[model samples]
Structure formats: C-alpha cells, structure tokens
Target: MNLFIGLLNMAIEKDNDRALYLVQKAEVLAEIELFYLLPHQRRWRSWFPEVIYCRVDVEKTRIYIKEAIKKGKWNMDDWPEMKHKILKLLSIDDAIIDLAV
Candidate 1:
C-alpha cells in the first residue's frame, strides 16, 4: 500500500517522471514478492496482486488518476500511449457513460 500511496503522491504532484519511477519501483517490489512481507502491512499486501495487474476497480483507480490529472502530474503529450493505457485500465469510456446520467 505504501507503493500505491507513493504512486498517488507522484500523481498528485503532477510528476509523471517521478510517477513512472515510483511505478517501476513498485513493480519491482511486487515482482519480488516482498511487498507482502512487511509487518503490519497485511491490508495492502492482500491487494498487491491487483495493484500489479492494475486490475483494481475503476472507481478507485479513477480517483487517483483524476487527482493526478488535476494536479498536472501527467501530460498527454509526454506520455500519449501511457495516457491511453491508463484510461483503458480504468475503463474511462465506461466511466464516462456512468457519469452521463
């Protein structure tokens, strides 16, 4: 969860480079299977797999992404493909429809 929080912080800071860096770091942590081994960190560890896969629910992911966007942590031009990937991961199209009501 610390990794997720770090990602969120990176996004909120509009630091795409930093965000990517943190993501990479988190990925490494996830891959090593050490993300769940910390004491008193079971809650986050339980969700480690989903975080690695970016398979978290759209609503939750959206909050972080939206926050990042709002804070200017990401720039479309700098990460065009990544932007789309993030949107797709969060099912932005479906979120749009859901918000249309």
Candidate 2:
C-alpha cells in the first residue's frame, strides 16, 4: 500500500535511534512469529498475509490476552521503565528449552 510505503520511507529517513530500535525490535518479534503457527493457521495462510500470517502468533489469540510479554529488550532509546514492565509480562524461569521448541 502507498501508506505503508510512505511510513517505511519516513522510518528510513528519520535517522532516529527510537526508529531504529523499534525497527529492530519489530524484526526480531516478526522472526519469532513467522515460524510459530499452528496447523490450522498455516492452512489459512496465503502470500502477503500481513494481517494474519505476518502478525505475531499469540499461542491462542482466540482466548483473552492475560499478558503481553516478549523476551529481551522492549524499551525505547531511554525508557527503562517500559522495558521492565514489558519484560515482566510473562516471567519464565526456564525458557531456554521452550525457546528450542
């Protein structure tokens, strides 16, 4: 879409640390989500399915969102408060094994 292209261009032109950080964070989240789909969702997928396929896979989005956590840094260029809150969403004592899965 033209709007999407425009936004991308703006993000690229800004040369802002917040923009860069957000872009990198989004890429990491996308990479994590890209492969995490159930069989039924996979069947529903299609080319350029950004609204569905490309979006983060919420283990069961059909259910309510009890929390919203993504491991690692989720802060702005200088917002440690946000980082702490976001990281605390889903505390995992043993995530390495789950990361492998």
Candidate with top TM-score is 1
lDDT of 2 by residue, 1-101 (tens): 47545665677677654536466546644554567655566555353245522334444431222222233222234575654453345342234323433
Alpha-carbon RMSD to native, per candidate: 11.1, 14.9
For model 1 the local lDDT of residue 67 reads 67
Model 1 worst lDDT run, 10 consecutive residues: 92-101
Could you tell me every candidate's TM-score relative to the true structure?
A: 0.35, 0.24
lDDT per residue, candidate 1, 1-101, as tens digits? 58766766666567555546657767666654554465445446564545544345668778877766666665567768877887887766535423433
Q: Against the correct fold, how does model 2 do in TM-score? A: 0.24
In order, what lDDT does every prediction score?
0.62, 0.45
Q: Candidate 2 local accuracy as lDDT? A: 0.45
